[model samples]
Target: MKHTIAEVKISYHPNRLKGAVKITSSEYAGKVIRENWNQGTLNLYEEFKILLMNNSNEVLGLAPLSRGGMTGTLVDMRILFATVIKSGATSIITVHNHPSGKLKPSQADINIYNKIKDAAKLLDINYLDNLIITEDGKFSFMDEGY
Candidate 1:
């Protein structure tokens, strides 16, 4: 008997022209993410997403990683990084919404940011700001000196 392994292939297709909307700062990122978010659920539950970008800070794509209850959501680093790598993004900005309209980063949020930041350093990926989106406004980790 003979056994064969499956072949694995990886690829990335640009849905939009390069540098269509360059990310200049966390505030700009918030605007972009807000436009892509589902406003109907902004204050209904917790959702985590990522903004994938190229070397020039051009938009590559936005991916919703997970959804959870009113309090928190699960972010699997493996899934997050896989999406980042597959998108051919050189940088990533993490975004998550708080239904309670709170802009402060929770301890869990900080922990996640630290893990992603550290892992990004190891993988040569640019880890940008982590934004906490509220119904009224947003919070930036970099702006607050995280």
Candidate 2:
């Protein structure tokens, strides 16, 4: 189901995200990320995949992995990887929202990240980043050195 900001209450908390995406000066990338953020309420759990050119960092595609509950999104790694592979994307970034507005990564979140990282490595695809977006903005685990 699609969610709007009016349908949910969001709580903003620090440490809500545990991973990061590399910042590029590309306006298109920024716009895509922001547009997706605006599409739903803060803290709504949803998974998105961003395809990036290995050489120029140009954004290739932005696709949703899943639409989840208020607080959690279930991502299928196979679907995520398949999309990236099919796009011939050498690198990709994964993003998800936390409905709680807390940016801290949960144990489950870390575990999932590790699994995705490994899968990407095996496929010779770079998992560029896993970002946590909230109403306030976005968080990057790689930026924070997580």
TM-score of each: 0.96, 0.72
Candidate closest to the true structure, highest TM-score: 1
RMSD in angstroms between candidate 2 and the native structure over all alpha carbons: 13.6
Question: CA lDDT, every prediction?
Answer: 0.93, 0.67
Model 1 alpha-carbon drift over 4 Å, by segment: none
Q: Name the weakest run of 10 consecutive residues (lDDT summed) in model 2.
A: 12-21
Give the per-residue lDDT digits (tens) of candidate 1, residues 84-140: 999999999999999999898899999999999999999999998899998789999
Candidate 1 accuracy as lDDT = 0.93
- Candidate 2: where is the Cα deviation over 4 Å? 1-31, 43-45
Candidate 2: global Cα-lDDT? 0.67
Candidate 1 lowest-lDDT run of ten: 10-19
Question: Which TM-score value belongs to model 1?
Answer: 0.96
Q: Go through the candidates in order and give the C-alpha RMSD of each one to the true structure.
A: 1.2, 13.6
